[model samples]
Target: MHIRKDLSPGKQSLLTTGSFLIPLFLWTIVSYAPFIWHPDIKLQVSADRSGVTTVFTAGDRVSKEFFPTFSEAIRVENQAIMEAREQNKPIIGSRRDNLKKLRHLAPLAVANGWLEVKEQQNDEKLYGVWKGLAEGSLKSTEVELTEENIEVIRSNWRLLSAYAPTYDSKRYPTEAMLKLIPQGVSSNPVYLPAPHEVIQAGWRDFTTKPDNDMPTMWERYRHSLTIIFWGFTYSCLLGIPLAILCGSLDFFSKLHEPFIDFFRYMPAPTFSVLFVAFLGTSDAPKIMLVFVGTFFQLVLVIANTTRLLEKSLLEAAQTLGANRRQLLKRVIVPGILPNLYNDLRILLGWSWTWLVIAELIGEKTGLTGFIDTQGTRYNFDRVFPVIILIGFTGFFTDRFFHGLRDLLFPWTEEAQTGAKGPITRFILRMSNHSSYADRTKA
Candidate 1:
């Protein structure tokens, strides 16, 4: 309640928790509460259209405006099949295709607790699900089947049962089965998947082996980290020394600042093709882009921090007969190191801002690449998890570094006023005064 004052640690932690929970609470309300802005129907059961190759399974979302049209499309296809059956000229069905349709219910069965996740492809297990539903043995608690869909379930079960008491893929009937009616509950648009839905999707995608020889999510995550590591490390290698020289000497400052100032104004992305042409499409260009995105501003900021060293510190060193080398080594370097650490930490986050653009420069790779691919396909559920991964990665990284700052620079105003974490206390105990077992110098 005090003005311009830091709150207690308990209050700070409470506020931090509330910051995240507030948004999550609003999201849950939007996603779950019936009277909220849920304008779409998230499918709990889905089916294939006769000629459409794009098979929508359970968990797909469609706008309320469009759901009726989607339902009618499948309804028309089913009526045509029934008429064909009545005329004793049933459409010639591929046994494999009809068997595939029965397995299509696998997702709904899993959702309804009628089958296990792995049982989706277990044609026999899924057949049992169909029989249970048809005979009113398995209840659809989470997602009730529409009256039309229940009838389709019974009708399909008849064809399946007549073929055999249990599933036999080779013995599947050659008669076309009716598509289940699409049924769903109200939901937000695709971009705003429910929290539970996101959690389920993230778990499934992360654990399941990716198809098409692409990298796993963790692989992509590591690749991103690698690019960031090299880029920031290289930036430090060159930028830090240049920044130190520029800050400590007028000659170095005049030599470098104007050109660096001019180059930074040109957007870093404009050099994308140039970096690719010079380095070729791979990690090299991506690393270079992150470097470019970070390096110039890094030089300017650290140089300014260097200049901010108190004049009395440098004047006193000179008066003590310390030469230029001694002044830089003893006075200027130590004077700026704390602030420099903070500058580098801030710039590291700036480098991450370039990650998405950097990854897009060449052959797209890393988490950003996965996000680009999934986003373009409108698989926002999958995209959300990756995005959340990136955010968590960055947020916690900054937090970890911030935590270390107090331990690393205990003489600074922040460290002097702030509380030390257990890791900090343990590290100080190990390094500073600990000698005899369980005792240290006062």
Candidate 2:
């Protein structure tokens, strides 16, 4: 709790864990609690809009205001069909359409334990479910079917039965069918899917093979990591020596600093078009954009860190009759290793921030490509996994590098500062005292 002080490791780890957990805890509450910030309804069962190509399947969420409107639209259609039948004029639809219509209740049947997940589109199984429900042989307890829906099911079952006494896709009725009314539970907006939902989505995406020629989730992930690795690697290759030379010599500093300072302000994305034209639309442009975003800042920050090295240390090296090359190679480079390592670690993360922007430049690729496409399509649940993956990759990469610093530069203040908790110190003290007592008795 003291100013400019590290917490005991135990407390620090606990608080670090809490930092992530607290946000997740809040999200879960907002998602699950109906009276909380559930401004939308996540569909448990869903239906199609007439003449609309956008099919909202089960698990799609709609705003609460829109849910009733959506459900009512289906009801109106069913009601019209009902009136048509009573008047001895059946509104016959395409047999294919009727077949698709019956399968719309598959989600409802699945939810009510009347249909297995794999059997959702199984029209034969679904037809039997409708018969059972209409005849009262099966019932829905988990999610009670609305009274209106029960009527629709019975009416639809009668038409379907007379068309064919049992399940027969070929002989299924062409008479217009009832659409399942959209049903859902309270939920947060699509942008903030629940934790289990995110997990399920992540698992599905990572495990499932994507359609078309698109790369799998893990392939996209590896591509993203490769981009980061190369971009950061190229920057370090070129920037470090220049930065070191600039920090150690005023001549090099005056030569490079002015142009770089101005160039850094130009913003990396502005050159996206230029890069694409010069490099063509491939990974080359994307890699360059990431490099451009990170390189200028890398030079400036490392130069400053290099300059922060102790003047006394340099003076001692010079007083020992070391020449300029000796001071540059042996003193300055060796002296700044700890700080330089930290600077590179931070710049590595900076490159990640530019990944999405870089991916957008020409042809979208990598995890950013998937994220951009999904985001544009408003599939935020699918998008969350990639975003979370990027965040975790950067976090763990930084932590891994930070841990390495302790072993690599044990002389540094940060490495030496593994503070002990009070309980840990107390236990050690008692153990030492017991050892001393035993020694005295001996």
Best by TM-score, which number? 2
Once fitted onto the true fold, the runs of candidate 1 whose alpha carbons sit more than 4 angstroms away are 47-57, 72-142, 155-179, 205-213, 421-426, 429-442
394-430, model 2: which lDDT tens digit per residue? Answer: 8877876776675567587765565433443344456
Task: Estimate the lDDT of model 1.
Answer: 0.86
In candidate 1, which residue pairs get closer than 3 Å at backbone N, Cα or C atoms, i.e. clash?
Answer: none
lDDT of 1 by residue, 289-367 (tens): 9999999999999999999999999999999999999999999998898899889889988888888899998899998
Tell me the number of clashing residue pairs for each predicted model.
0, 0
User: Once superposed on the true structure, which residue ranges of model 2 sit more than 4 Å away at CA?
Assistant: 1-7, 47-57, 73-100, 109-126, 137-143, 167-179, 417-442
Worst 10 residues of 2 by lDDT: 419-428
